[model samples]
Target: MSALAERWRAARPKVAGLHLDSGACSRPSFAVIDAVAQHMRHEAEVGGYVAAAAAAPALDAGKSAVAALTGMTADDVIYTTGSNHSLDLLLSSWTGPRTVACVPGEYGPNLALMAANGFDVRALPADGSGRLLVDATAAMLAADPPAIVHLTALASHRGIAQPARELAETCRGLDVPLVIDAAQALGHLDCAVGADAVYSSSRKWLAGPRGVGMLAIRPALAQRLRPRLPPADWNLPMTVLQRLEHGETSLAAQVGLSVALGEYLAAGAETMRAALAAVGKLTREALADVDGWRVVEPVGEPTAITTLAPTNGADPQRVRDWLVAERGIVTTHAEVQRAPFELAAPVLRLTPHVDTSAEDLATFRDALADATEEV
Candidate 1:
């Protein structure tokens, strides 16, 4: 069998086990879950807090693992509950009368942060496809130079990754810091490690437990953050993390995230990227010919996400329901006009991780074909 064909065959059996609403199944190499499971068993056998303390070293090492994964320094990594929580912490650290400029269709809470922080918020128009025109974002920043310039590595709704270099380059000359919401970008795309702060949720692509998230703060900007926890020193790896890592953290989960992150990095972004690309490609090809289905192959060097929309006689939600209820094929759907693409419409996201096989894609394709018929 060909390389991709062999991969698909290997991935087929695992598909039967999935039950999540978002067809967001990544490759199985993210085995941190198994580790978490093991840790949980140990905790049950031992005491909860004691088990956590026992694993503290591994948990601490996991922080470093996250740093290596995202290209941020170990000291900059702060473990939080999830990306939203980390982003909220980062936004809270910034205050005062500052203008925040974003390409239209920016994520919700960030705009809310701008409004809540009393900073004037402005949005530049997006391209026809609702993608943030990187040049336009740069122009907006140059013309306005707000205290903060923000862009998402990938929009949560549309699966669109705003051109990092374009947005980052535009901010280069300005005093304002650039913040990239990397939640969707972490496991799927190559992180450039340029932004002032990058946040990611462990669940999406990292395959960690949903409760944990990571924030990568540039070491240079470490002093800039208004630490949330009182008078806590951030000089140490454990100390610097206090600024954001709120809530009761799961020791085993963190270790699992660390383990999963290590496995992911070892596979190398190149191998993972190639594996996901094959899956995304198959999804695009399979859905492309179906009626009332719009399949997007992003030009910003697309990731594992394959988006689908109805062409005619089908609302996106209906198509999604059909796929889920009838075919068991999971996916994301985006309307063409939302900036960051992932945030706009209900996306039928199909992320074929390294663990997904070509046969699974074939199964999904058959389901997609059947689902497109509209009952």
Candidate 2:
């Protein structure tokens, strides 16, 4: 077993359960938790409204930190409840025709949103390895044109990294609007993609508290996006992003998210990314020789997500349940619903963070072997 990152190890206390489900939700550092608690305490001390007004500076700082995380300015940032809500706000406000261009490995919820909003999905052609082909995508854009180009920077299952920068450049040349689902890539990879807009959840990878997400819109695209919500007051005018995030919000969650982003930047984003990548590689290598398991992600891809499927008819959910109940090893299941076109069957998803140690991964491997046998 290898040692965990020193900075992260000191900041994050040990957990009772061996947490390997960071892709689903990461454990926030003590500082982030305390920030949230402090806001709530302030609310209790003063009135909720008064407390929120006082916390406005901290809330604005959080938005700025999130904008920095995505290489954008504070004015471009909009806070939402989570990734799904952010995507809904963006998609629902799209005034373009009922047509969208997306890769085959599009996030299932985004696909569902497009269908629900009366947008027809056009699958872009991909290379043999399931990556979008630039020429073919351009050709598609030229021919049966779509109203918007949607890209999931990283697949939720199998940790497949998409060619987002290249696609962004292509979309810009084609004069098309590009929106990126950056939930998994925000904290794990280099998130500064050249896209018109990017949205992500705070819980994953960033180690921020749940119930907070971020949306960054380019200035040029901001005014073009039709405002979805009406102004609360007749005299008050709001920017498109402000209208999307209008009304009351969770002040405590917003403060926590800001702290989390600050912590990530202080710890060094590239250092955390490299540490997480090593953990993913170690997990894949450990399970490479395991009898009835197959690692889905290819080597050398910079991702913290590792997906494994049972090769000998072993039920994935049964294995997951056994691991939790018997071994206190927490993991998640990636069903076909996450990415229907990319994933063939249900997979066991193991997402390790910088705090994850080699010892923890070894324990998970042993537990998984036992679960496969017992269940």
Candidate 3:
């Protein structure tokens, strides 16, 4: 293992077996775990309000870290339950026409959320591989600009990293607000794409505790959002973006997120991205030779996610179950519901982090061969 991988493995002591499911949730580091426990203990000793007040500085640092990660100011960031809540908050608070331009492969729940909020969702121009075509998207925005443009920097069902920065630049030139769902891209890929707003969860690539996420909005766009709920007098001291945050939240999880963000920065963002991309390429190349399976994403795609479709009419769920039960390997069984417009059936998604080793990949290959033969 490299020094970085060694550090990652050391931090995650409880990661038993080969954990290739970072897309769902990563193994939280011991520092993050300890931070959560310490904060909960403090909350138990002190009142919740008092404990929160005492944690103000660390929480501020956390918000600053999020701002740094998303290319926004510290005052522009707010906490939410997760990506779903963050998107709902942004969509519900929109004061303009309920029309959103997004990629056809936008997350299924996001599509449902837009429908719930009465948004007329339209698909952005993309190539056959589902990557946004910058010039075509620019022309579409010029011809008929939607209320906002939304992009998932890295999708859940596939490993193709979207052209977020190009789209952001297009939106900027046209003065169209762009909102990005960075739930899968925050720590794994470069997230500072200059979008109007960016939101992500703590669990996936950040390796923080679950139940915490963040939204960062540009100051001008933040001023335009008109949430239906009446603002509290106490919230007036906060920035327009921060006003979206409700009073009740998990302080412990917030502290854990702070530690996790700190760890990512210490690990060097570029270094981590490079390592993950290399691992993703390795995973694709190694799995290509595995019989009875087909690698979905191209080997050159720069992402940490690799999806495999079973051949010979084999069920991916059964293979996933068999891997866990027999081989102690973890993975995700992605269904069409994950990307209703893009997928035709289910696939087995393997998302390994920096800690994944060559030995681990070989073990998975052998185990998957066995799984295909039996299941």
Cα RMSDs of all predictions? Answer: 3.9, 1.9, 1.6
Ranking, TM-score, top scorer first = 3, 2, 1
Alpha-carbon deviation at 372 in model 3, angstroms: 1.6
lDDT of 3 by residue, 1-375 (tens): 899999999887866678999999999998999999999999899878899999999899999999989998888898888999999999998988999999988899999999999999999988776788889999989999999999998999999899899899889999999999999999988889899999999999889999999999998898889765555444556555656886677989998999999999899989999999988998998899789999989998989899999887779999999999998899999989998998889999999998898888999999999998898
RMSD of 1: 3.9
lDDT of 3 at 17: 77
Model 3's alpha-carbon lDDT is 0.91
The lDDT-based order of candidates, best leading, equals: 3, 2, 1
The top-ranked prediction according to TM-score is 3
What lDDT does candidate 1 reach at residue 89? Answer: 77
Output the TM-score of candidate 3. 0.97
lDDT of 2 by residue, 1-375 (tens): 334366666677677789989899988889999999999999999989998899888888888877776778888998898888887888877766868889887888888888887888989998765678988888889876677899888778878788888888888988888888889988788777678898999899888999989899988877666654683445356678878884576878888988889888887778778887888887787778788898877866678788888899998988999988998888998889988877778989999888777788878888888999998
Evaluate all candidate structures by whole-model CA lDDT and list the values in order: 0.65, 0.83, 0.91
Candidate 1 at residue 162, lDDT?
66
